[model samples]
Target chain A: MIETFRRVLRRLGSVETTSVLIVLCAVIALLGIFLPIRTSNWMVLPFALLMANLLAALATNARLKSQSMLFAFHAALVAVIVLVGLDRLHAMHGRVEVAEGSMFDASAVAAEHGLLHDLRLGEVRFLQGPFEITYAPGMKRRETESVIRIPEQNGGWREVRVGDHTPLIFGDYRFYTTHNKGFAPIVTYVSASGDSRTGAIHMPSYPMNENKQGLAWTPPGATKPLKVWLHIPEPVFDEAKAWKFVKPTNTRLVLIDGDERHELSVGEVVSLGSAQLRYDGLRSWMGYTIVGQSMIHWIAAASLMACLALLGHVLSVLIYGSRIPAAGAEHGG
Target chain B: MALEPAPRRRRRSHLIAAALVLVVIVAAGVVLEKMPGSGPTVATAPQQSASSGVTPFGQAFAKGIEAMRLGDAHTAARAFDEARAINPHIPEAHVNLGFAFLAMQRPREAATAFDRALSIDAKQINAYYGLGAALDASGDRKGAIGAMRTFVHLSDKKDPFQRKAMSALWEWEAAENGATPQQGEADAKSKPEAAAAKDAAAGETTASIEQQGGAGTGAKPEAVATKDTAAAEAPAPSEQKGEAGAKAESTAVAMLDTARRNNAPVPPPLPAIADMPDALTPPEGVISIVNVWASWCGPCRAELPSLQAFAAALDPSRYRLVGLNVDRDRDFAREFIRDTAVSFGNFWDGRGVFAKARFQVEAYPQTLFLDSSGAVIARVSGTREWPADAAEATVAEILASGQKKEPK
Candidate 1:
């Protein structure tokens, strides 16, 4: 029974098993990205199995105990695999589009996080400020600069300028600016109780559907939905020259009711059903991709150590093997 | 000692490996637990109300435009009437009013507004075309033919409505007689077209009108939008946000202001040194302390010698120190350094240009501390005493896999 168990453990930890697991993981990851199937389970199982195999090898390999360089190499490999498991357990990845002059509330983000993801993102408070984008002659974007405001210990917001090259780093999370920004209109709905709620209505990807800009808004305590459309008076982008990213200076909100038509300009207010709807103004929104991998630094260090150990093992084998064979040949002769 | 202690040696070797693994795990756990932010925040608080701040003309004109856009004949007619009552010379208002009346199937009223617009300007293509369509829809056969003929004569070749006018003329001519056109005049020519077909098709009447005047139906909003000089000249909302957005405003303007107020230029010329690397970017896995100072500043004068001493005592491979002298007087700055008898990489910055623009430094005698990865660890202001051991320990603590230490 002990011999059978020993053979089974050795077989599972063999190089062949690890190679098969790696190939299987790669295929499943590709399927997860391209196919509309639940392939995450398939991936997790193999990676978990591979990590167990590495651990088994560390415990049972008797030669690795005597050979210090080989032992260190295998130990480094174990460390790397363990870090990968920890990363999968705690990593988070998500995207959020924050409107200018608006606070980035963590709960509002649509994100995917690992099971053990720590949800204490409130330590760094960020208020998105107005961003600027420069365009080439044909309206091709050349540069993008997003300004972020962080709360200072002394109570005022400290400005941090972030561009494509300069990413905002908070803890293990890194925020990169992507080419996914558009315009957002500030809409205020004043209820019959005189209570007002202000929110940003982000448009469908801009220039993607430049002619269409609208949203359906229902005031508090009202059953009927108000039909709202953004009535821009001019071309947002000029073909002749570079233009600044500015909200329509005279954006008009066209509201439709039952046989009633109302146009409210920027800073305009009018009555709707039992409430007063105000078009406070327009603002721009910026998109950001946020990634959290807390164990990446440890993984990188482990990888470096693994490479060094492998080098040491190779050198030791070359030197000692050559010396022993030559000394034996001379003695035999 | 070596031969008798095999068990002890094995235990000691195991202890080292165990300690390494434990240290790494603990460090990773601490870093993840203390990282800034983990999720989104909920913003549900009510904001202040936007009070009455509309211009009488802007509001009324906007109402007229929106009503027209919505294809609401009665509401649009009332809004346009209000606008004309306020100022009797807006020809666009009359043209839009005619469109509204025509959409309502009030041909006589539509014809009257269209005629009034033509009288104001004979070349008003919309008025001429609308008059012809209105006349045809009202069953006035001869009048419709004549009005359409006039419209075809007066309209430009590139006018979008010209081709529609010709097609409608042929149909009206056929309708006058007993010949049947492809589409009945009652179905095609009687209705005004909507720019956005789906949105305007909310009502049966709007859908009908939307089909008749299909000129601006697919046209861009900029083409359909009237060139309202009043609206064009009005101040943008961003300007208005300046005073109202006191809690926040444009970041560019704020950045510019900070740049202007930071470090001003000093007089006299400072000599350039060849020893220091630009920005004092330390090599990988090494800590760097960049001290920015000016000769005229009293705090900076006092802090130089100790920093030099501390720099010399630190392990060369792990730590580096650079000094930035901001006095423009090269001789004076050089003399100050010589008199202090300090050694370490030092460079001359006569105007505080690099420090102010890049690091947003607002004061003299500022020191920037950096970690091994070249990330800004912390920036200390005023004067700091850097005894070698204390600085080294702090750097090591920062490098450890644990909770982030507050920058000194």
Candidate 2:
């Protein structure tokens, strides 16, 4: 059994076995790219095998063991692969939309995360403030300047302006502004039973669904839902000229209940059968793409170290050739 | 005994180094675990719940339909749910509920509802379209294409949604083949069935439910969107004559003949103006309705009478109606307008620059609703009966929206 184990280790440490493992990893990676398989879990197998093979090679290969630079290079490569694996295990991607003046609710976010992702989004608290977005002609979105307020050590708030490029980082997570802003109608609802509540209804995205600016909403206290359409009497933006994102002041909520349609302006009230709706005003909402922090820096560092060690080993071999004394050569001499 | 073997010593040192590296990595992991914000927490998805009541199925279904017509998918869903609770066998309720869920962006629930509808009634045509759309949204393109194909096969050729389904199928197939819809459409020309489907070709097909030639039960499924409700209106006298109507005018033809006598390809209807006028820049407090039209466009000529009447009836203080003639040959446009007796302020778009660039118009007879600031409030493609109440109601809605902006 001991002899068999030694033979297996020797085979695993062989260059031919390393080449086969590498080819298998490449094949798996290619399959992942071409096919619709999730590579996150599948990648761990090949990497783990490669790491084991490398360790076996480090232990059994006498010539390799004698070379410190080559050994260090291989060790750095192992570290890089391990770091990348850990990173993949904990990475996450998410998206959230917050209306201006609203608090960022972590629970409202839609995300996909790895198995070991630390869900600490609840610790990240911030409030969305006013944001400005510009558009070029033909409705091509340009820059976005979103203002967000984060809590400070002192009970006050510290304001930060983040945009498409900049991210509002919170520990390991980052919130980046995306080009998905739209109109949000703030409305107050009063049920026939005298219960009242108010909130904003985020409409469909602007310019993209400019004509279809309608949404079906159920009020807080109402039994029946109502359909609300934002009616803009004037041009939203000129396709011929550059423009900025702004809420139209001259817009009304066209509320439809059953067969009845009533138009309401700001502060105006319209009665449905079971409830009454009051148009408070219109506001804007911004969409954000969220990403968890990664181990990319460590991976890059390890890779750089590996490259340097490999370069040093190559230079040593080029300069000294086989004259570089092996471990037994020095002692035997 | 005193001197350890050099190879063994070196191996032990390598082991120590490997152990140290392992210890360091483990330590780093431990530090990271102990770092701030690494606490155990669970992310919760937003939840939505609906309440049901003890209501009669008939009343609930009616309420659902009314709510759907009003665009209230939530209420419609609830009502349908209530109706389904009272009577789970009704396929229409399930179908409508599926559509409501679709409107709410819950494609999974919509698919379930559509599946239920299909389980109840295999021939529920609307359910197939809803199922296809839901499946498509849920990233099941193959299933979506299958469902849409089934819908097209089961539906009448004249069914309005059949054309939409055909368009969707073409898009999906094109996507699957790594080609564009235009390319798919080009390929479709060879297949007779696809050609029949392609004949509709968006913004041109004018078949209505009555023209379905008595296919199925004739139970019209409610439109998912409220836009383009006027697309099914009957054609006008000019539309009945089609392109031949443009040649009906004696004076217009005579002027064209005069241009033909000169051997010039229909010279300018009148003396060539130095420069074409710019697009309509609305005055303060006035809303402008720019009707983009061309003499060659049959639908443009068909809707001219209603537009003329609607323009005449508009309140001059608040609204201004104008014509954007995109006819390349100025003679045809000038004579056509003269023959038609259209008096609205006509601006020439001989080169179609403003029509294409400013309005982004693809089809003719598109009306742009611009505010006093010359910002486009809305763009209605295709034709609508201008004299109808729907048109007036649309304008009234716009007027109501702008009421707050009126100078106090």
Candidate 3:
């Protein structure tokens, strides 16, 4: 039994084993980069083999133990690998549209996250304020600056400015602004039973879907929902000249309810049976990309430290003689 | 000296490192769980009412309303809060508290109070209005408009607060339309003389139609809805001038308001006819009877003669009768109209825009009754023999039902 275990350890600790594992990891990584696979599952076996090889080398190879710098360098590399795997398992990416003067709702986010990602987004509370976006001639969008209000620890709000490049960082999550924005028609529906609900109907993306700015919505306690379209009678801004994004004027909300159509101005109400729907006004909604639980910074730091330690080890080796003689014969050198 | 082997020592150190990593991970998880803002909180309110007779709760509630009416907002707020503490389920206390907060110029707090009131009883109409006002003051103009619109929607037409809410909502919405709030206010306050002149003209037209009908038949037609009891008992037409005319007009308006509150479905204007020809356009400022027809439908072909006779017999000054052709081919519809010798101006629904899906035209030869503002207020389905006398009475009834009055 002892001989079998010893033989296994020797094979795992061989330099050939390390080289084979490294080659396998590199091939898998190359495939991941080139192929359409989005999951990290395919690389797990290669990583496990590399980790096992590192552990066996630490156990069976005496040269690594003799040099502290070399050992620290390899240890940092192991830490980097572990942290990267952990981050991949826990990372989350999501996108959400929040209207101005409205609180951010986590439930409204369309998201994708790793299986191990702990969803604590609901805990983050903030209100989005008005955002400004400038457009160059020919409708090229520029930088967006959005203001947000976050509650402080002691019963007040702190104003934070977030832009395209600058993210609103809250604990482990960061919200970055995106170019996707459009008008949201604020409306209120009052049911016959007196249940009133107010919500914003986010129109299709501006300019891109300018011609087809309509959606179907069902009111509370109604059997049938109506199709509502925002009709801007005239051009909001000139695309030929540089302009800023602003709400359009003289807009009408056209509602099509089975065999009937009603065009409502702002503050105009239309009755659907006993219930009523009112088009309050319009507000702009900003789209934000949310990233959470990423360990990229830690991984970068560990890699840099490992590189420095490797340099130090190389310098020490050139200056000094063999430390308890190199285990070259055992390594098959 | 007896010592452990180098491999054994290394293996032990590896085990120790692995254990340390596991411990660190566990510690991190525990810390995260115990951290503040990690857990979500659920709001709970007492569902059942506790008030029975006059108690401290009643006294506090009464005090709040009295203080509010006296314009002592601070005192009202305190009393409402006291009433809420005594019985948290009372929605009125929360609504009054919201109003009090609004009076205090603390809109955010007022919004919260209104929200709480809504949670207790969603039917609290005043809470929605207060919430809108609070949101507007707090710079959430959209939310304010939503709340006020909902209030107007639920409130009775004669509710004193209804006018105020509508005026405020118009001002806010006008501001959104690139106009100053004051400009919106001014626009809302001003009533056009043109509208009054149109009403007067409409009254004269109805009276002339009545005189031409030569005796009233009390038979209620489907096209002329007199759903309100008061509308049925309305006074007969009399030639009153000046002060008497103004008083009659006021009475007519009140009766119309009551009829509107009886859940009358007011259809909006048809989609813009940019693609359609100008000949198809119905004239504005007069009641229009649009007769929908298709060349293929036998009933539509049969009704063409009666529609022609009805149009010829009607006084052209008060009412305009037009024909909507739903035939796929415009030439076919024109040829059919020419064949029938129908002189009325005909519009071809070539795009099928005025098909069964649009105007609920379940059958061919359906007639739509459009008010002076071009809103389709009523409809008459199937073919009917156009007797000049019955047609005049129908027109008179539609006019008397306040169809000419613009929707509020």
Candidate 4:
């Protein structure tokens, strides 16, 4: 058994055995492209068996004077194959869908924005077909004023579809839509006592202007001149109040402690006493997007690149060895 | 020294081979690592409100469109309502719902639906058309004309539907505006003949009218009214001649004016005949796999090799693979097939008949696997790996089974 093992080890380090292994690896690589790795696992057993046979064939070959580089190359190939197998076995993947006009953060929105929390959501609504459903995250329930009926398309309802770039995040999971808009409403609250405030609010607020006719009322008067401006454009504005409507402006506002005023923009948020306000800018209603990648995939990719580079170097040396010129007839021919 | 050099060369060859193998192994490993897995598993929660489903309003809208096309007005309305319930901001649902109402002949409800759609999306063309139709059905010709005029203003003149709609709007406007005392007297004198002629013309004009509001164009109403009146005065055969004569005279005059203005070629009259081949039926008794593909689909291009191999390996007597090219340009499809050296039968499906009616395929490289009886058995809608052995096995299994017919 010891002799047989030695013979196999010697064969594994032979040129013919290496050539067979090369063919085997090529075939496996080609197969990997076409078939799911899970279903293609059956091919791996045969490949291993073939590898063993090649090693056995190499054991009987005459020992070359130098074998370090060849052995290193073979070892590298084995290492890559083993690592890939492990990666395929352990990899994990999934998808997420995000709605339009919604925001999602896995960490504290406050830490990043220098507000209070890692993530902050304004107002969120779901647009299915004719039905509109508004959701308040704090309440964890639907709001009565949120449901709105929309027009249909082609005698049916219009749908918001998502793709990779367009994602709708509810909580942690994100949904992407094929088509998305880059507009969001900015809600600013002004206290009654003339205290000005600004921040990003989710839903459309009463229109604000110098006259403040369209603006929503400030908390019952304490006198610092207060108003709440909802900056997002409504799909259907009241015809009578049409003149007051303005295109959603990037400018956002928030009143801190009903005293200090801060203007926020996209990717910024303001802090009010006990309540954190974020200016989540407007984005188009895109659907869910699923990202299917794992750490193992990255590791495998890096290893493969290294192997390819090493292979190229080895090939160059073999094709242009110094002995070729010496073996040929002298120029005096 | 020679012996040592020989050994070195042998070692080098071994290294090269081993290195190649290593590269292959590493490449496979890297690809496996980079291979994107199925997207994150959607957290399956307990049954929640319908709104909680991540289904977008767009998909619901598409469903509503499908229901409407099937002539299920009630279902279409329900779908629209569901879509609106999900996203009230989309204007398509209201317009489609109004269309459904119009189909059900509920003019008031239809008008309201159109109003709602317009309120959401002022530029929506269908809403205006539905509004006009509802008004016309309710005998409010003036309101209908106003709506139709808006539709015409928003439509492109070169579009076939737009041209047809313009003609209808013009005729309707003309008939309403051209109520001369003489025409009224004549109509009163021969009400029966006039009514009969109007009935005959209605059939020919309905499609044009429906198309008109959607394609908005401001066509001259006077000429259209004259044509309508003439059609009402004559019998069906005589009406055709009168209409043809009027069209020729008007078209000739328009052409002359156009030529003089720009020194350009005279434009052709209406009903420009298109040079396209009539639809051909696939061979009988063979399962025709119609693959709708564009040259742009990477998956489609990748799968071509496998498909070609399958085609080469298959018994042509048992199956037929037909590629229905849905490209905007026919030459592109031809060139692609030629460059790829694909040996499968190909045809242009420019009319989008198969796409619209049978499969409703929205994505490219969609394959509809048909049974020998010419019924669709299965569909592979996206790019996928086709293992030769597995495919052959599936084909054999399909052949062996007695259940060859697909359920309609």
lDDT of 4 by residue, A198-281 (tens): 422222222211111112223333433323332221222343332322233333332222222232333333323222343444
lDDT of 3 at A64: 65
**Ten residues in sequence with the least summed lDDT for candidate 1 chain A:** A324-333
**Candidate 3 local distance difference test against the native:** 0.63
lDDT at residue B260 of model 3 (Cα atoms): 22
Q: Is the docking of candidate 4 incorrect, acceptable, medium or high quality?
A: incorrect
**Among these predicted structures, which one has the highest lDDT?**
2
* Chain A TM-score of candidate 1 vs. true chain A: 0.82
Which 10 consecutive positions of candidate 4 chain A have the poorest summed lDDT? A205-214
Q: Highest DockQ, which number?
A: 4
Question: Residue by residue across B1-408, what tens digits does model 1's lDDT show?
Answer: 347575456445645654554464456656654655323323332222323355565456556544543445578678767866765554555665666666566778878887887777676555666677667667676786788788779755644345445766776677668787654453353231211111111122322222322211112212212111111234222211111111010111111111222222112123353333345667787778878887667688778877877787778898888787776544445434533455676778666766665556669898876665555677677886767667677555544635343332
**lDDT by residue for model 1 over A178-297, one digit each (tens)?**
777777767788776789898877765565445345556665678986656565556688857887766665565656553333545566555554466767877778888878856876
lDDT of 2 at A69: 69
Cα deviation in Å at residue B270, candidate 2? 40
Error of 4 at B361 (Å): 18
True contacts kept of each: 0.02, 0.00, 0.00, 0.08
lDDT-based ranking, best first? 2, 3, 1, 4
Candidate 3: tens digits of C-alpha lDDT, residues B1-408:
899996678666656544543444445545554445321222222122111223576557556644543336688689889988988876667776776666566779979988998998787776786688678778898897898889889975754345556766777787778775543443344322112111221133223213222111111111111211112233223221111112121222222222222222222222233355343334665677888877667687778877778888888876789887776545334434533456787666764565454566656778877765555676667776776656777666655665443331
Residue runs of model 2 more than 4 Å from their true location after superposition: A39-43, A136-140, A152-155, A221-227, A256-260, A322-333, B1-6, B9-408
Residues A174-282 of candidate 2: C-alpha lDDT, one tens digit per residue: 7899978798887877776888887779897886766456767777856677767776656678977899988776566666555334545565454454456767778
Pairs in clash, predicted candidate 3: none
> Which segments of candidate 4 are over 4 A away from where they belong?
A8-13, A31-39, A46-73, A103-333, B1-408
The CA lDDT at A89 in model 1 is 78
